[model samples]
Each structure stands twice: as structure tokens, then as C-alpha cells.
Target: MRRKVRNYILIVISMVTGTVSFAQTEIENPFGLVYRDAITENLPGKVNIQPVTYTLNGIEIAANVYTPANYDPDKKFPAIVVAHPNGGVKEQVAGLYAQLLAEQGYISITADAAYQGASGGTPRNVDIPHNRIEDIHGMADFIIQYEGVDSERIGLLGICGGGGYSLKAAQSDKRFRAVATLSMFNSGVVRRNGFRNSQVNTIQERLKKASDARAQEAAGGEVIYAADNAIPTEEAELAKIPYDLYREGYIYYGNTHKHPNSTFRYTMSSLLYLMTFDASTNMNLINQPLLMMAGSKADTYYMTDEAYRKVTNAKDKELFLIESATHIQTYYVPEYVSQAMEKLNVFFGKYINSEA
Candidate 1:
């Protein structure tokens, strides 16, 4: 099984390289968005998308903002800051939800994190926890100041790894009135303990390698990366992956929803900081209204469950489960996405929408 998975990964690497080469020309959407019914043009009187860029802590962030139909900049409107998953860009799941929320009459903004996607950062693909958390905060900083946005009605929606960061960001960032997560992935815990604690015995060993990677970077040596290998070529090999999150994630990020900017790799030195961080820690700091959703059958659901249980001080905190859906399914599957959007609309409406 291990050997098959490895072989499959090798195939994935070659395919990804080829996909990146022709992505710009082959993609049907003008904006390079891969999701269903993505915005093709900025039509007036409908949900419109605007590509925007802003500097965040010396790094430029690439972002997309969605406005509701017949949007008037003179009138106040509630806003949401949507954060993409690890290795995901603004054109994927994050943008999907942002557009969906806009259809529900809320202004939404989704941005590529620094050092990843199209955001400007040196030594790209760095996945430190603090930086990701700041990305969510930066999104809020920019969105609240956008035209037609009511600063006080700002909410947050983080998907997958972004969901975990949203928890940490909303912990002390009182600017967000409502906070939500979909298929939350606790990156720090997974990095330190491995998915489902699969690498428990190798914790210290991995830490040493991360330290070595950092030392090599200090000496200006070659940059080392983790998870930069190929993925399965056959369905049988993909099924061999022990976790549903990984098995489906490969298909979602590597094939059906492949984007040139998306990648599974992160700087090896990043693990030095990633291993020490814990998204579930300081959970009590999130005093805002909270809503967390995950697939009932998702292998990654445990992380969301654990984190949700820790939000003792959060107001009206709720844990929603999308039955029969897996982690990656919530990203693009129409049925699962509709369920999530329905719940999000109600939750965000009650907390952030002025009409509620």
C-alpha cells in the first residue's frame, strides 16, 4: 500500500507540472477560477467580482472581493472575510463561498495568503501559523475599509486550514462579530503529531529535520520542502491512503480543481514554528459568536470537534455536520456546498446582518 501510494504521488508530480504549463490557456474562466459557475465577467446589477491587491505587513496580498446584486457603495453592507485552506488560493473554495455569500447580500473578500498563491513573499510556500492567522486579520483590515462595507458588521469564514487560523485570529481580533469554519483542519496539531497521530514516534525526528532545514536556509543553501512529491496515478492506489482527507484532497487539489498556484508543499523550515503552535490553544479568547461545520464522515472531523469543544466562552457556538460528505467534498461538491451555505447564511445573518 505504501509503495503504491508513493508511485501514485510520483504520477501526480508529473501531471501537476504539465497542468501548470498549460493552465493559463486551458482554463475556461478568464480569471483562472476552476469552481462551478465562476464569475466570467464583471456584469452590472449582479453579483460582481473585483480583483484587488493590498500590502499586508510588507507583503502584497492578491484578493478578490464579491459584491451583491445592484450593490451601492453609498449604502452600508455587512462583510465577510473568507480565508482559503492551506495550499488553496482565492480562486478556489474560498472564492466560491465568497461569491455565494455575496449572492446572499453580503460583501465578501477572499485573499491569497502571503508566501502562498499569488501573494508576494520571499521563499514561497512558507506555512507558519502566525503568518496565516495574520492573513485572516489582514483580510478583515482590507474588507472593513471597502466601499459599502459596514465595519461593525464584519464576519469571518475560514475553510479547512484557513478555518483553523480563523479560530486563532478571532481569538483576540474583536473586529469580527461572527466567526465560522468549514472542514476545519488544525494544521499545527497535524504537523506536530501527524494526521491522526500517525507519526507520534517520529515527532522529535521530524523536529530535528525541521531545525536542519532552518539551519540550511540560514546558510543560504537549497530550500527544502515537505509534501512536494507526486501522488497516486490510479484509483486503487488513491484508495490505499489511510485517511479520507488525503485521498479526496488529491483529487480535489490535484485534478478536478487543480490551480497553478495550489500546491501541497510547504517550506520544511516552516515546521519549526508549525510544530510548536496549537490552534485549539487559547480557545477561550474567541468571545464572538462561533459556528463550525464539517462532514460527518470526514477523517479530519476530529480536529473540528476537539476545537469546538474548547470554545467554552464563545457565544451561541454551534457544531454542524454535513452528513455523508467528506472533508474535500465540502469544498466543491454542489450538494455539500449548498448545505454549508444554507447554514452559513443563517448563522452570519443572525450575528452580522443588520436585518436580523
Candidate 2:
């Protein structure tokens, strides 16, 4: 009788454990992927931007085109299509840059990636290479459809991960006349090795972790979202700078900088896709103008440098190192933003004006 009662208790415990293990908690996309913000807190005047929606490779995408507050339909203008960093929306710095350039008498638009923020997708933030690169081509299609704009004079600026995508797009698509990156991130490189090749030594361990995550995902376990949580300990003397940045700075700004929705995370399993992406494979074939900029102190410097070295057909290519600046500082800081804008203007002006 005692043995039968013990067996019964064990069965009940096992049933509960299995139920909990396979349970799926519903995850909602609260941000909706659509981003809209006035260029100024006070709001700019009479800006008639047509909020347009388009589909890229069957996925619905949304973007906003900002024109000058004093825009005249009769007068044609040059335009730019901007790409934001991974996990950022158009309301962030990307919109600011686009709007700033729009205010300077040009047309500009910014977009949301599929499945994140307000863009459409099933498994959110999956980071498939084809979708990301195709997004820019789709944006180019939208830009070309606009009336009263010089179709040949369009430019693109991508910040962080968007920067890498912008370059990748320009490699094949001839729509963008010039391209620039502000503190760019090589998503593929950063994913496989880490911000500055810090994880190159741990490639195998990372692969093991990704395989395990996939197995769990394949089973009844919930899909997990985990950012790289590299924190610098008291052992910083031996720690890599990228680890320290995450341990210290990324934590502060990530939690406080954007406010309200600051603490955002992505899937840990993305490493499987990212490790295999190499944007530089066809990078040398691009015959366009390129501007690659990074904070001299940014842990991401190597990404831009690697990309810069791979391009062979660029009519003109330049790399700028912003002094004493780190990666995130360029996002919204006045000085760095100003510097980036000035260079952007110069880069675009030189190429587009050459037609005149």
C-alpha cells in the first residue's frame, strides 16, 4: 500500500512538470512597428508627408516621407531614404536624421524592419539576411514612385546595423547614388565574433548554445529572447572592452536613454543565422560612392574597417574616425550628430551635384 501511494504521488508530479515545460506564453508585438514623430518637439510647420504603406517580398512594410515644412509641389527636390539601427524605430535617431535633411530642402523617409517595432512578420526580429537586404530595395522602390523628385539623386544613410544593410543593398541595387553609415555595426561579424571580435575564441561554445536553443525551441519550450549579456566584472584588467561596454554603458543607456521602452531584447538563437552572414562576399563589386564612419573609440571600428577594405569598385570611398566618441554617443548627441550630418551633406552633395 505504501509503495502504491508513493508511485501515485510521483505520477502527479511528473504530469505537472511536463505541462509546465510545454506551456506556451503568448508574446504580443506592442510597438506595432510603425514609428511617427515630429522633427521638433515644438513640431515643424506645414510638412505634408504622405504616410504610405508598401509590401516587400509579400511582407507589409510601413514608412513616412518627410518634406520641408514649406514644401512646394511644383518644385522638384532630391531625396534620401534612411535605415535605422537594429531594434530601433523611425521615431529614434534615424527619423531625426531624415527629418533634419528634409528640413534642409530635401525629401526623406524612414522605415521599420519586419516583425520589430511596427513592421510585419511572424517570428519577430529573426534577422534573415535576405529580408534585411530586400528591405532597402523595397525602400528604393517607394522613393522612385514619389512625384516631383529627381529619381537619380536619391541617397541612403544607415545607422548601426542599418548601415551594414545599406551597404549590402548598394552592392547590387543601383538606386542609391551615395551611401553613408553613422557608427555602423556589421551585424554578421558582431553576431559571430562579438562587437570587436571578442567572441572569436568562443565560436564553438556559442555554436553549442545556439544548437541547444534550437532543440529547446523545436521541443515544447517557449521561444526565448536573450541579448548578449556580457558584463565586465572586477576583473576588467583581463576583460575585453566590448564586454565592459555592455557591462557598464549599454546597461545605463539601454535602461534609461529612450525611456519607457528602454529595456528591449532579441532572440539568442539569431546567432545561427548571423554567424553565417558575410556582407563583404560581393562587397567589392559595388561601383558607387561610400562613406564609412565610426567612433575612434567605438568597439565596432573593426566592422567598418573590414567593410572599407573589401570594396574595390567604389568610385570614391572614405572612412572617418570621430575622436573620443563611443558607439552609442552618435545616436542623439548634438556634437556627434552635427558632425555626422555635415559629412552626410557633403557626401551626398558631391555625388548628386556631379549630375548637374
Candidate 3:
């Protein structure tokens, strides 16, 4: 019984870690994508997916650029740079939204963060807040220069942890004319205070662990990691998790939408930076149009709400709540996804497209 209780705790920790990394698994889709209805082969006159690689701060970044049906390179089109969720890759919900946005006639790009997924970096899954924010900026840099993309009309979409980083990226990167987030997750806040502040009492203990991990790395010791356990596969075990974000997250990332590059683990030292960062800080710097979306029923909604409330200088800032949808449901549920896409279309169309 004690062992079972410990296992349950570990599973919960794994679910809440957010950032992830692991050995690559063989993906069944031809494009190495795991999302539903992923583009198998690029064709003419339909939404086409292009595999792209570019260097960001000397690290090779892997990304996917989606073009609208009957895309014309000669004619400039508004584009969106999509930032994937924590422990997520370009091929999951990020790809789904990129594809769906493309279907709506917008060019979109989603990239794996540096040190995670197929992107190049050392000390794999070093998920510091600054690096994550830079990843969002890097995606913006690449997509803005892509053929047929209007440099002046680039928008941003970030999911989950990516949403928090995107908020930071848009604070200074004027290239993102419009900014939007779905299921925004403040990784820094969670890492420091714990999910809903559940682990607040352990802040000092966790920080000590992170400091020790960093010292070990400096001394060339085997890197310490956090939340490296595999997700529980049994229904009885999964039901033990309390939070909806985590409970459904296991089902989504572990079962239905499992991808080769997704796992919940990060260098323990990353907590040094993550624990000090806050997505809500200096949000007034985002002077561009902003649209923040989250499920009304999501346990993580507080993060989005708090961040949204801090955007004092944003032009036309709005908080959109998808009724009856939890945080994870907004990732893949057709009903919730459709609702998000509908609102995104109107938001991006209004701000990024001059013709609209």
C-alpha cells in the first residue's frame, strides 16, 4: 500500500512537470506527426506541410510550415508562429492548430523548442523560462522570413506552457502583430508555487535540489532530472491523479495523442530559472492586439486569467473562455478545438490581415 501511494505521487509529479524529453520513438505518420488527420504527403492545391530546419542561436531548430490551399508564393499571406505546449512537440496540438489555421487561409508554422523534440540542444530538456521564450522568438524569426509570408502581418499562437512563453515573446517582439494563447500555463509559477500552490511549502526544498543539480552539472556529474517516470497506463492508476489538467493529460499525451518526442522530464537545474520567472510580469509591454483563450472548467484557468488581467497596455485585449471545456480538452476535442479556431479566425483576421 505504501509503494502504491508512492507510485501515485510520482505519477502526479510526472503529469504536472509540463516540460518533457526522451529518446525518439517511431511515429506512425509519414510526416512523423501524431496528431489526427496529419498531412501524409504534400500535394498541390491543398494544405501542404513543409519540413524545415533553421539555426537559432547556433542550435538547429526543426519546424513545420503549413500553407493554405492553392497557395501562391507570389502573393503575400498573413502567417502565425505557433509555440507548442510544455512537453509537447510541433506535431501535436501545435500542428493541429497550424493545419486548422492553414485551412482558414493563413500560413502557419510550429517548431520544436530547442533542446526538446527534434531540435538541437545539450542537457536535453533544459526548460528554463528564458530559453522557452527565446524559442517562441526564434519561431517568429523563421516564419517571418518564409516565402509568401507578410513580415508586417505575423501573428502568434501558443498553447499551454508555450502560451506563457508566447506572452513573454510578444511583450517585445513587435513582429507578432497579434498574440493569442490557448490553455495558457505559467510554468514558472507552477514550478515555484506548485500547481494551484499545492507545493508551496516545499519551495525551499525544491530550490535546494535545483541548486544541487546545477552544482553537479558544473562539476561534470551525471545530470539530475525531475519527473522522469513513465505515465501510468492502467485506468485505476490514472484515476488516482486529482487535477483534470494532469488526469486528462496522461490520456492525451500517453494514450490517444502519444508522440515519439513527448515525455515529462527536464533537467532538475532548470528549476533555478523556472522558479523565478513569471509570465504575468511586465505584461504591459505587449502593446499589440491580444487574445487569450482558456477553458472555463480548466484548473489552469487561473494562470490565464491572471496573465490576461496584467496586460494593461495591450490593444484590444480579450479573455475568451470556452465553456464546459477543460484545459486538455481544448487541445484535441473537436468541439473545443472548433470553438477555439473560430475565435482565432476572427481575431487573427481582424488584426493581421489588412484585407479583413
Candidate 4:
């Protein structure tokens, strides 16, 4: 009985550490996207990647631009700017979707926000709402001027937290001819109310803590943050943990899809701004075509649903759901991703090319 108990504990530990059968691939690229269908290296004579850097508010934002096979600077093409999740960098799912869209002949770009990823900024991982919104606008500013891009036909695709920011960006930056979001997560909502409103009663307390964090930063003190949970390596303990969102997120962002610059934590001081912002507040301002997608089984599906309903002014709109897929699964799971890409292709094609 003692031996059996010990073996069971070990199994739980492995699960907690994300050392299970699915996450066993050897890390290949510094980007650390090890999923089965991940495109780690650029394919010769096909999709080409250009590492780019541009200044945004005196900070250099790092980005990757993917051009399709047989790209010609002489031929105009519709462009798309992809926004990464809140805790994510441009090199993960955002990059993946941008590359796949390029495969279908659209020029796509994904960039690290000013204070995150390979981008330059102080007070690292500060995830304020306005900054993320500006990041999307900045991507539009850059990609609109790229060679062969049709500025009037530029589109936007935001994933997870990026999705929320993209919506806010589209509210005023009408340069985006069409806007789309995948697995939309309302960062402001989750940050303010807590995931699933679990911390609704503690809102004032958390706000006070955020206020103190800001004061500390003002005094040049150490940064304070949330979401620094240590990775668990025990299967029993891991299995006991609930919330598939956090569990699978750890497996992806922290393990299989880990990148050197992809830490998900954000400054606790950001809550001062995050808790009061609402990405969907001015949904009526988005007067262009819009597409919002979420996994039907995602715990965060309510966000997409709520936001989509408020987009009453979109010239055309859709809220697509990937059946049987959870929030994190849609990030890299081949079938779910393919479904999203297919829908995006048709949506962008119809709207972006309507004038041409």
C-alpha cells in the first residue's frame, strides 16, 4: 500500500509539472512553440518572415511580418494586423495565426506590445488597457505603409486579450476595413470582476492593493503583481486543481508553448486602470464589418457573447463558435485552429475585397 501511494503521488506530480505525454516534445526554436502543427521555421520559397522593429511612444516594438509565397511588392494585397493575448507575446498564437493567414495570400503582421515580449519598455509586463489599444493602432500605422499593402483594405485579428483591445482600437481607428477576434477575452472585465466574478466581494480590497502598488512604483520600490503561481509537478495536486482555463493555459504558455519572453504576469499597479476600463463600452462606434469567435465550451464564452451583442453598429457582424473546443484549445489545436482560419478567410475575403 505504501508503494502504491508513492506511485500515485508521482503521477500527480508529473501532471502538475506538465510533463505528460502531450507536452513531451523537445524545444526546437527560441520561440518555443512546440505544438504539433506549429510553424517554427520559415519555409523556403513559400511564406517568408521579416523581423521588424518600430518606435511607439519612444519605445521600440518588435514584430514579425509574414508575406505569402510569391509575394510581389508590385501587386497590392489586403493586410491584417494580429494582436496577441494580454499575457502573451506576438511569437505565440498571434504569430501562428498570422503565418497561417499569410499562407492564404494575406499579408499579416504580429507585434509585441511596447512593454511586453521583445518590445522595449520599463516596468515590464504592465498591462494597462490604453497601452494595449495603442499597440493595435500602432500595428495599423506600420502595416498600412508597407509595400504592396492596400491601406483601405487592411483588416484586424485579435486573439484572447488582444481581441478585446482590437475591438477598442476599431472603435476609433476606422482604417481597419474588417475586424475579427478569436477566443475573445475581455481583459478589463476579468481584471475588474475577477475570473467568473469569483472575487466580486473583494473588489474594493484589491483596488486598495492596486493603489498601494502604484504608490510603491512611484517611490521606486519593487514591482508587485498577480499570476506568479509556481508550476506544480505533482499529479494528485494537479488533478485536484480546478478551472480548465488556468490548467491548460499553464500547459501551453508555461510548458509546450513556452517562450523566453512569454511570462503572463502583469503589474499589480495596472489594476487601477484595468478595473475601470471596458473594451465593449463603445461597441456602437465600430461601424465596419466585425467577426467575433469563441469556443462553445470555453468558460470565457460569455465575454464574446456579451461584446458581440453590443456591436450593433457593425456594417456586418458574426459571432462564430468552435463546437466542442475550450478557450485555450483553440489557440493551437489543429482542428479548432483550422476552423477559425477557414472562417477568417471567408470573412476577410468577402469584406476586404468587396471594393476591389
lDDT of 2 by residue, 1-356 (tens): 01111110000103133221112222121222112233322234755455678888778887878887766667677888888787677656677788778866678888877666566876666666667778878888987777757788888888888998888888888888888888777778777886667679988898778778778888857666656433222333223443423532443233222322222456667778778887667888678899998877777777788888988889999998887666776765567777877887788878863458
TM-score to native of every candidate shown:
0.92, 0.78, 0.92, 0.91
For model 4, which pairs clash?
12-234, 12-235, 12-236, 13-233, 13-234, 13-235, 16-232
Which is the winner by lDDT between candidate 3 and candidate 4?
3
How does candidate 2 fare on TM-score?
A: 0.78
lDDT scores of the candidates, listed in order:
0.88, 0.68, 0.88, 0.84
Task: Give the per-residue lDDT digits (tens) of candidate 3, residues 1-356.
Answer: 01111111112223355333323333356677776667877778889999999999999999999999968989999999999999999989999999999998899999999999999999898898888889988888888888899899999999999999999999889989999999999999999999999999999999999999999999999999988848876766766788988888987788667777887999999999999999989998999999999998999999998998888998899999998899998988788999999999999989987755
Global Cα lDDT for candidate 4? 0.84
Per-residue lDDT tens digits for candidate 4, residues 1-356, read 01111111001114245444443435354334434444556666788778889999999999989898868989888899999987788778998999898988889999998889899998899889999999999999999889988898999999999999999999999999999999988988888898888879988998999999999999989999866747654445545657768777776776666677888688999999999988889899999999999998899998999999998888999989998888988988788999999999999999885556
**Displacement of the residue 15 alpha carbon in candidate 4, Å:** 15
Displacement of residue 287 (Cα, Å) in model 4 is 1.1
lDDT of 2 at 155: 86
User: Per TM-score, what order, best first?
Assistant: 1, 3, 4, 2
RMSD of each: 7.2, 14.0, 7.7, 6.6
RMSD of 2: 14.0
